[model samples]
Target: MKSKGKVYLVGAGPGDPGLITVKGRECIETADVVIYDYLASPALLKYAAPTAELIYVGKKGGDHTLPQDGINALIVEKAGGGRIVTRLKGGDPFIFGRGGEEAEVLAAAGIPFEIVPGVTSAIAAPAYAGIPLTHRDFTSTLAFITGHEDPTKADTGIHWASLAKGIGTLVFFMGVKNLPHITRNLMDNGMAPDTPVGLVRWGTTTRQESVFGTLENIVERVRAAGLKAPSIIVVGKVVTLRDTLKWFENRPLLGKRIVVTRAREQASDLVKRLTDMGADCLECPTIRVAPPEDWRPLDAAIENLAAYDWIVFTSVNGVKFFFRRLFETGHDVRALHRLQTACIGPVTAETLMGFGLKTDILPENYRAESVVDAFRGQSVAGRRILLPRAKEARPVLPVELTRMGATVDEVTTYQTVQVRDNAEMLVGELADGAIDMITFTSSSTVQNFKALLPEGEPLERLLNGVTVASIGPITSDTARELGFTVDVTAESYTIPGLCDAILAHYQRL
Candidate 1:
């Protein structure tokens, strides 16, 4: 007989992926199988190993799903087969999540299990809406009550009339459908008809929405607002704090739709940071970098490295592709012996440094002009300069080097080709005004954005109400020439600075 494996009953927290506890994330990463409920955010599943099997046991209102018996049996069967099973639920599993029943079954089946506590929705949902459950002036006591009960229960144990006066604040989970009945019950039981109430839907996620009103009008207001299920209802003086405590919606890029035009592989960090700052990010890769069409030029450049006095790299891709060719040609960083190297920016400089070649000149400010200034007043009449760069880069460096009387050899180190197909989903989203902002990291991105989009709907008009943010002046200038107003520009050309710029803009507004 196979040894039974231990089971982990984990709470996934509210809908926000980040709200998941450290313990919950650990179990999810190691579990052989994950059984998740509907309320748990689907994003959490990405943390599990690719080999782990994911089983969905979520039940929506009035929807038939895996019965409790079957779910419990599946857990036991998997554990008995020596599999580590994770029962993932939204919020604290033991609190109104029917985790008690599941635990009972596991215990009866002799399957050892551990319960990992979660940030219960009862607290998280209200807190996300900026409502504190307890306050000295409002009320010291708070109560959590389920608006629904088991159909076959011997009695509806809760006394509505007594509860109306027993607690200072009342939080109702799974109560949106029965809002009318609940409101009437509270009022009929002597609670004030005008007590403040707030409904938080999709709490803790980017889609979170809050609707506030009095007990007498909240039902009608929520209906008018089209509030859906998976919402929490809070009724008490604490609900009044939302106006002052609300901060999430006020983030710098909170409602802006931004477009990211970097390669998909390199865009995740920037996209995630922008999204976390409350901007809706649209990923559309305008330029895809690939190995050089032929490495002869780069190979020759590496062979004659010492013949050049200066080697300039304009982008990180140039450094990467140039070195890749060097290695392929049986050369190494030693090939760069006795040559002064200049990088246009920190990113390029860091890439070169990674290959054990420290940059001799990195501009304090990252720009072509700053690079030119770095070598100002230096004699170059007899010096040989080598430039390994992208095929379509600007002529500024070569033109300036020629004017400086230096013998410059500019060779293409890599190729940047356009993506043949436009992302239909991104286009559809743009057409429907679903986007909030568009971020351009380069002039190429701005130009490509226009190229991918339909002609008549100029990028400016397509982004009429949306904000256009750029990483620096060059990208901002490209956006301006294309007739789109630049909304935010980072003080520094980096992702963190871009996020800070976006946040500062919103904070000032």
Candidate 2:
């Protein structure tokens, strides 16, 4: 006699992964089992607990993974077993999502359930494309209708007459396939042929594209543009406003597919910045950061922090891993009060500042030569300096410091290993000339990316027409040594600098 668990039919919102409501995200985090749809952004899955079981019940038009009855039965079975289930739908569940049918099934089975509404594509897609559904100047009334209907029904369920004449604005979801039928039906019902229309594909994302035409030629235009399903179709005089109001399509980096070569854990900021600028960023993390095989040297350095006059950090990972080891050994930030801290760049300095520590030295440029120059006027006749950094980092900093009469004890805090999760996919994309650019943030990312490629694959052939963007000169030199034509270099050697260079290159084109 086990008690039943509750089910929540939650809406995942429109295409933008960020559009999901906070409550919807919380439901996913707490759910014991999550069943998501094809339209739901895969990025939302990161919110679910790692222990939760995720099942895909995606049902695209004419391609049902699980029939409606089967989906209903699956939910009943999971809830009966006392597992909380989150049924993630694309848009507002009650609107054309068949949420009512599933809820009725759960009700008949005596399962406790709740419905969570989402921002439907009907309104969101058009809005992201810069079209207002209702306007004081255009039309005041709006209607939402399905572009496809059931074949089993003997008659069409939609009222074509009222929609044509009465509705001032019309939005059809999943309507690309039935464009001809939809246009003919509207015109037959006395809708004017000259009425404007707009089709938005993959709206609200970096890959979003919009196509515009009048009702008389919209179908042909959609075909010419090769717009696919999961598109939003807007009809009526409101579509005319898209030309004056289109903002997303006019972005500088729109439609450009760029690859990010930072480590997976560190790629978020770079990815977000590029996506915000309308680049379709592919997160291809080249290396993964991890603890060194042995912690003895790092522990020894921490135990003797009082003997050192300077502690230098070369990367954000160095600061992160060094502090992690410090806290793990029962020491806090106070242990470093006797030592002055120096960082190579602003990003590393910011990470150190996050731990309530101030930097004594921050070089203007992000390089070992710059750090060496920054310490030229200081007296280091007999100062002991401790550097905790990547295992395979360059030795120029320590070598130069020792010449300046300083005793430098460099210890390895972390190591980076190459990752090959999608090497084959990357190769395919490159071979097909689908990739437009590849960005390198560090020398390690550049090295590991070359290592991940198939041995002896000609770099020139792979990057024939692709632009190579580097964060700084050090990274750019490494890319050049590998025979890559460096097209853009960030003057500031920062994430935002790299993004600006990429945009500037495109703007010039």
Candidate 3:
């Protein structure tokens, strides 16, 4: 007999990644294998260890990835192998998620298992849309029923009479397909023809769409609006609350698909900001940061750290690598007591300060030219400066310093390599007119992104309707030189500044 492992039937919450419980996230992080559904936020998978296996068994409309029986067998098989399995489903695993059925199979197989409850869309979708499921002023009784009833059953199992007349609020999931049938059944069962009804599609997501009409005309309104499946239907007077409390739909960037062109390691801050404002963010990391090919120059610089009068860090990567090697070779921050540090921007300076080092100079603008201008007014004659930066970076700073009577030793601390993952999906998004904007944080990002597109696909026509955003003038110039129209440029060349610029651009329209 094989030693059995534990299975956690974890609920992934309705849609928002933040809505996930702390316990649920921990299970995913420690699990050997995670079986997640389509309704589960992709962001939640980020918590899983890189070594974990991810299986998607999402069923939307009639398109089923894995049937229920297959999923049950897979869970039992995985657990029987003595591997911890986290079966992540959307909403509470108990609430219409068929979690009970899978749990039964696990029990029959004698597999150790536990259930972690999650926020179901039946409650969260309406709440995010600002419709309370239960209010004292309205009715306190609430009923949650599946919109998709089994056709093979002798009759519809739902008590239509009780739901129509007795229940104060009726919430149905996957009911868009049977909207007419649901409405007719309710009205015929003594429910008022004028009952207020609202359907929220893609609820609790950035792409959420809500349509409001009475039971008499909701079907027509839903048809005209072209709302599809994966929606929640709400009945009773609570439907009227949407008119006064419609908050999520009013978000500035809601429904806009924004592409993030930055390193995957560095895209989280920008991604969170945009997603918080209701934008669908796609992380297409253009450049991957890694150790330089030759560490001799940087290694030598670290050994002779006291010889240099000033150390100039052009990027956060530079500061990170410099100190990492400094400590690795048996050096510490105390070795820099006699040295002064200069940085290109506040962000770079902030990164430097993180090491308990003081910044002697920070240029007014976040550009190499600004760094040069700052040095132009200072005393640089007969000074030795050490610069550690990207291998492919421009030589503007070092070249200008050499001409200013300063001996400069520039070494590559890190290099940015291009990443081509999901380029096909990116091209498809553009072709389908799904992307509304693309943001570039650096010149390297801009160049690498262009290289990812299919060869000979006219950039002009391929990105005709999409807006191009730049972090600053340097990136904007690179974008323009590459024949992309720069639609928005940040005043402050930072991720937060870029977010503000993007929001302001949409507001102007």
Candidate 4:
């Protein structure tokens, strides 16, 4: 018989993927199967191993992927197969998430399980909207209640009289649809009609929205604002603090939808920076990086490392792939002791430094021309140099080095091929006029992105109002040659530079 498996009941936190607890994330990463809900941030799936089985049991409004009982059965079935299962639910699983029911079922089935509490939206939503649940001057007591109780029951479980008179603050979960009933019950139970109330929707995310009013008029106000379910309702003087404490919604790029056209593996840093600053980044990786068709040339160069005087790296990918191949071939950084290293940018240099090697030359700008200029002062009379980089990279560096009397052997370390996986969705978004800006980080990204566009469509008309941003002049030149209007170009030629340029462009507008 197989040994019994363990189940982890993990709370995935509020809508923000960053809000998840470290332990919860660990559960996701180590689990053999991940069963998640609708409210759980889809981004959290990135933590799961590639081989992990992912099942979505999302229930939103009236639509249900799997009912609560079915979900519980599925969990038991998976865990019974001796697999480590992670049940990922949105918010604090114990709080109105039916987690208690699931846990009880697991206990009856004799399954091993652990509970990982999550950041519930009841508190998180109000906090993100700038409303503190308690204040010394206003109220020091708080209570949490559910908005959607069983309609079939003859009596409500909530004690409205005590809640209105005793509690200093009230937070209701999933209460938007029953806003009128909630407000009326409070007023009827002697709560002041003038009591402040606020509702926050999709809180703690880029799409968070908030509305406020007094109990007497809040239902109408919410209706006029077009608020829906899956919202947090805060009832008390604490709701008034939102006017002075709102921060998340005030970010410079709060609602701007931007597209990032970099390779998927390297897009996270740029995506996080833009997301933190309040831009909703749509990752459309136009190019995918892979090993070259043949590794013999790179292997040969590595085998004869002693003959080279210098090894130059033009991009982060180049440095990583070269060092990786070197290690795979039973060689290490010690073999490069006789060679000087030159990297095009600080990022590439930093990557090289990770291998315990120091860079001899780093250009101020991250382009081939700047690398060539930086090499002007070096003595290259009859010196042998090895250059390992992308197959489609510009030849300016090698050409200029040859002019300075250096015999350069250029070998391909990586290959970048066009990816059209998201092309259809991209064109749909562009046609819908949903994208505000598109960022191009390299010439290859710009080229591949252009190829992804549908044939015979007027490019000018499709991207009419969308701003085009380039990482540097080289990328901007490529965009222009392809008939794209480059609206913003970074002066410093890096990811941070591109972000800063985009921020400045928006600020000026």
TM-score (all chains, Cα) for each model: 0.78, 0.96, 0.98, 0.95
Overall lDDT per candidate, in order of appearance: 0.85, 0.91, 0.92, 0.94
Model 3, residue 60: C-alpha shift (Å): 1.4
Clashing pairs in 2: none
lDDT of 4 by residue, 27-118 (tens): 99999999999999999999999999999999989899999999999999999999999999999999999999999999999999999999
Give me the runs in candidate 1 sitting further than 4 Å from their true place. 1-6, 32-38, 52-85, 105-112, 148-157, 272-276, 280-308, 316-339, 346-360, 384-392, 402-424, 443-467, 473-493, 496-509
Model 1, span 1-509: residue lDDT tens = 88999899999998878889998999999999999999998979988999999999898897747988889899999998999999999999999988999899999999999999888888988887799999998999988889775534667767888778888999988888888978988998999989999988877777778899998999999999999888888999989999899877655565566778887656887989987877656667887888779888877888888799999998888888888888888888887888889998887898899999989888887777887788786677779999999887888888887888898899999877777365676778777888767778778778877778776766655666777788888889888998888889988887677778877877787
Q: Look at candidate 4 and give me any clashing residue pairs.
A: none
lDDT of 2 by residue, 1-509 (tens): 99999999999998788899988999999999999999998889999999999999898867999998989999999999999999999988999999999999999999999999999989988888989999999899999999876534779988999999999999998889988988988999999999999999888878898889988999999999998987999998988888778887777888899999899899999999888888888888889999999999999999999899999999999999999999999999999988888999999999999999989999999889999999997888699999999999998999999999999999999999888998888888999999999999988889888887778889889888999999999899998897788999999899999998998899899
lDDT for 43 (candidate 2)? 88
Clashing pairs in 1: 256-436, 256-437, 257-436, 257-437, 258-437, 258-438, 259-438, 259-439
Instruction: For candidate 2, give the lDDT.
Output: 0.91
List CA RMSD, all candidates.
Answer: 4.6, 1.6, 1.3, 2.0
Best of the candidates, TM-score: 3
Which has the higher TM-score value, candidate number 2 or candidate number 3?
3
Clashes of each: 8, 0, 0, 0
Off by over 4 Å in 4: 1-3, 150-154
lDDT tens per residue, model 3, 16-96: 899999999999999999999989999899999999999999988788899999999999989999999999999999999
Of the candidates shown, which would achieve the greatest lDDT relative to the real structure? 4
